[model samples]
Every structure is written in structure tokens, then in C-alpha cells.
Target: MKTNFNKEWKKDRIGSAHSGENPMVIAKMRSGFAAIGDTQFLPGYCVLLPSKAFGSLEELDFKQRSEYLLDMSLIGEAILKVCNPRRVNYSIYGNTDAYLHAHVFPRYNWEPEERIPYPVWQYSGEKWRNFEYQYSDKDHGKMKEKLSNKIYELMEKAY
Candidate 1:
């Protein structure tokens, strides 16, 4: 499927995923969609978007919650394999988006010594908006392909 680089998917991430309009989507997992992040400032960053929209994790029943959490971790593992960062960090904060999407960050040891200890959010706004850090198929396509394949491989092994 073609990746829609335009901002059309911003207004409706989950809906766009359902319609296959979100360019960031890497794979459709059992519980949600595994998508590359909008910014590549931290390469291999990703988000786990639920197939069905919900305000928070608690909105799901026990089994569904388990699947979602497992999917999140699996993506983290995939990131570890593909990105080869020092480690992976998983975060689910509905504060800004108010949706049940989890962030899978591949933390690297090469990051600035001062910022390495802080959360990805602690980065400057300029880093987030810098064109160099933005996600593009040209710069990130190969890695995304590897990550997508690894996610599928891990999923198969997982189940």
C-alpha cells in the first residue's frame, strides 16, 4: 500500500489505519497496528495503535488488554532487533492524543550524555520539528522494511 505522506492521517490515525491511508503503518498486528513514528529523530521509534479506538487501556477487558500490552512489548522487541538500540522503552500516555496508543522508543547509547537519562519527550521542540529528523521513506524505508519483517517474524514465533 502507498504511504500517504500528506497530513491527512493526522486527523484520524486509527481511521486512516483502517482505510490504509496512514503512511506510517508498518504492520497490522493481532491487537493493533504497528506504525513508525512521525519523527525519526530517534530512529526506530514506533507507536502501537489499537484497531478499535478507546480512550485508555482500561477501556479494554482483561483479555484485550493483555493482547494490547503483549503487542506493545513485541514491537519493542522488534525495535530491539531491527534498531539495535541500547534498550527499548514502552510508554502509553493518553494525555495529548487521548487514545490508547503505546510508544515504543529505541533508546540509543549514542544520544547526548545529558539527554540519555531523560525521556524522549525531554528533547527540544526544534528536534521534534527539524526537517532532518522527520520520517521519510527515502531515509527510513530500509529500516522500516526490516522492522516490519522482524515484527511479523516475531509474531509468528510468539504465537
Candidate 2:
């Protein structure tokens, strides 16, 4: 499906970060923006969105592509430092959204035994759509702070 970037993301999220309207943004990286995920089913889930919208990774120049991927890793590392999940799952599929972005999902040891050994996609639709897992400033304040701090620290070390 074709996505309306202006209507879906840039209008509500992308520029919101620059204008201080979106609190989910953790840090602005070399080639993109790092932000916490809308859902917290896995707690430390996050996303890496490119600074400039692209249809896919192949659309970016080599350097920008590398930087974007590196930024994704930085986000995973920051999550590892803060949440210490069992493993981090990285995915860059644009099938639904049609934008070049990466998802960083931290898998925990405490997850259901059956789900632990498989990709997060194995989880039910209810798990993904549950309002109970929605991000809230009140509930996720500490996590947001720690993740933001760690991301900044990692970014500084890279410079």
C-alpha cells in the first residue's frame, strides 16, 4: 500500500520531534532519528527513522545507508545498556509503512517459553494491538529517561 508520508509521519511525528511535540524521540543521530516504540510489549522496543524519508534502504547513498544502519545498532546497544534484554531483534521491512526505518525489539528471557525462541511476529495480534501496552509518559518515564541518556552517551562516544 502507498503511504502518505506527509499525512502519516511527517505531519504528526517527524516535524513534531523538531518542534518538541513528540516526546518519544530519544536522540537525533547521524543519519536519522531514534525514538521509543509506541508499544511497550517488550519494554525496550524502539525505532530508527531516517532524517529524510526514503522508500527503502536501497534508496539511500552508501554512506547514508551505512550511517542509518549504524544508528539502528546504536539504539539496540543503548536498549541493551538500559533494559538488558536477552536479545535484540532488528528488522527493516517497509511492507506496511513503505518508509525506510528500522525496528529494534528487545527480546526478554521472561517472555513465554514458546515465543522466546521465535521472532516477535509470532505474538498474537492482540499483543500488538493491546492498549495496555501503549506508551505513556506516566508509566514509561524512567525507561524513556534512561534510554535517552544512554543514546546520548553512545552518540557522544562515537564523535
Candidate 3:
């Protein structure tokens, strides 16, 4: 039977990270986990999920909030380095999932002229939700490796 992957991932992200079940995870940060997005339509899309389950960023203490934002920026920079997008967009919206997480999307200049300047959400529902955009091990492995290496390199330079 096919599994509800997102549900399963959300059930035990920490444990999955420790056990290596969640392949999207790139690195662990002080306040959260950095992971590549399951969808690669935008190339280096990624997310920063809080280590401890929290409803929203408002629930985090000042230090934790700052750390999460910093980690988000780290992921964005890594994507920028590896994907060479024209710009990176950062968004934190907990409307669907209550979990405190942030999305880092890399925007490319090659995108259609009409869609390039707008949010990714403005794309047609089919384009946004197409299963063809789903991650594949063979296709995405190199991207994951490049992003992971860039993230570690950035972390080293920050220290």
C-alpha cells in the first residue's frame, strides 16, 4: 500500500532524522532541522522545521526564534549557491500545518516573464500540484549533495 509520506514524516521527524528515514534532511541546526523540499520544481526548494514541535514561531522564545530565522537564511543561501537562482524567497505560514516551519524557494530568471515576478503560488493549480514535480532519488541526489555541502561550508565559515 502507498503510504502517506508527509503524515509519516511529521509523526516522528526527530526520530526519522536520527534513523535516516527522512532523506530530505540536510543538517541539524541549533533550533531546527534543515531539509530539502519533496518537490523540486523550483530546484533547490527547502524548509526549516523546528527541532521541538511548536504551533508557531510566536511560541518560541527570543533565542529560539532568532536561531530558526538564521537557519532559514542558511538554507536559502545554500540553495542560492547550488541552484544559482535569480533570488530566494522566504515564507513562514502555518495555515495548513501547525508545525513551526519556514519555506525557502529559489526563483529563477528563466521563469516565464508573467510568472517570474509573482509568488510561486500564483501558478496554476496543476503546475503547483503536479505529481511529476515530486522528488526522485536518481534525479535529485546530486542536488541534495550540492545543497548539503554548501550548507556545511556556510556553517563552517560562520564560526
Candidate 4:
């Protein structure tokens, strides 16, 4: 069964036996990073999508899953390196999107407002950064460039 993650990716690359989207256009293991939306509100908001679809991490082959986590770690490193927020948050719940993607978010301790574990749905005077907007196009591209370059550098050195 085709999943949501790969679908959007399909609009972008499909792999061989691999089920990743836009495998060609998408950044390689070491090419760069891709920002989902342009909202600059959150500096390092990225989704390290799996090359293929499996309901959960439990389904992926041990080696492939390990490598993906490593990649995610490298991606996370670049994210924190660039954003430098108070701390970082990683979310891998595939409930809504139903795609194999991980959320790499930079959490700040001194944020203007209080943000809880689950994002509040009501927009009522809520700061959009936590709920909606995060990265803006003008700055996001440049930031993505930095993060992407870092990933590429790490990828080159290792794999």
C-alpha cells in the first residue's frame, strides 16, 4: 500500500526496489537538506524521510534502519549546529502523515511562550511558530544550505 510520505515524494522521485520519493531530486545520503516549508520561524525544522516505506522503524531491516538513524543523527547534528537553540527535539510519530519521516525540531528554553509536548490546535492568540510557521523562505534557504553542506561534509568523511 502506497503511503503519504512517499506520495509527496513521488511528486518529487521514486527509487528502484526502494520506495523513497524523488530519490533523484531529493538530497542524497550526503548531498544536502530540504526544508519542508518556508517559515524561518523555526530555524532547523526538517524531515529526514526514509528511502522506503515501512509502517514503523520495527519493519526496516536492522542495517538499513541503523544507517537511517545514523543519517538522522547527522542531519540532527547539522540542524543544531546551524540553529543553536537551547535544545533539540526529535519526533517520529507516524500517526497523521503515515509516512516514514522524522521531525528534527530545535527547542528553545527561553522561548517567548510556553510550548507543550503536543502542539495546541487552537490558534487563539497562539504563536504560530510552535503550531504553524517556523521557517521563512528568505532565511530558510540560506539556513538549509548551511545544514545541507554540513550533512554533505559529514557524509563525505564517513559514507
Which prediction has the highest lDDT against the true structure?
Answer: 1
Candidates 1 and 2 compared by lDDT, better number: 1
Q: Provide TM-scores for the models.
A: 0.95, 0.89, 0.89, 0.68
- Ranked by lDDT, top first: 1, 2, 3, 4
Cα distance off (Å), candidate 4, residue 93: 0.6
Clashes of each: 0, 0, 0, 11
| Best first by TM-score, ranked | 1, 2, 3, 4
Give candidates' CA RMSD values in order: 2.1, 4.7, 2.6, 6.5
Across 28-112, the per-residue lDDT of candidate 1 in tens digits comes to: 9989899999888889999999998899999999999999998999899999988999999889999999889999999999999
Q: Which whole-number lDDT from 0 to 100 does residue 109 have in model 1? A: 90
Error of 4 at 14 (Å): 6.8
Model 3 agreement with the true structure over 24-80: per-residue lDDT tens digits? 788877777788886778898888878876988999989878878888888999998
lDDT pick, better of 1 and 4: 1
Can you write out model 4's per-residue Cα lDDT over 59-82, one digit (the tens) per residue?
787887787778777777777787
Candidates in order have lDDT scores of 0.90, 0.83, 0.81, 0.57
Off by over 4 Å in 1: 1-6
Any runs in candidate 3 off by more than 4 Å, and if so which?
1-7, 10-15
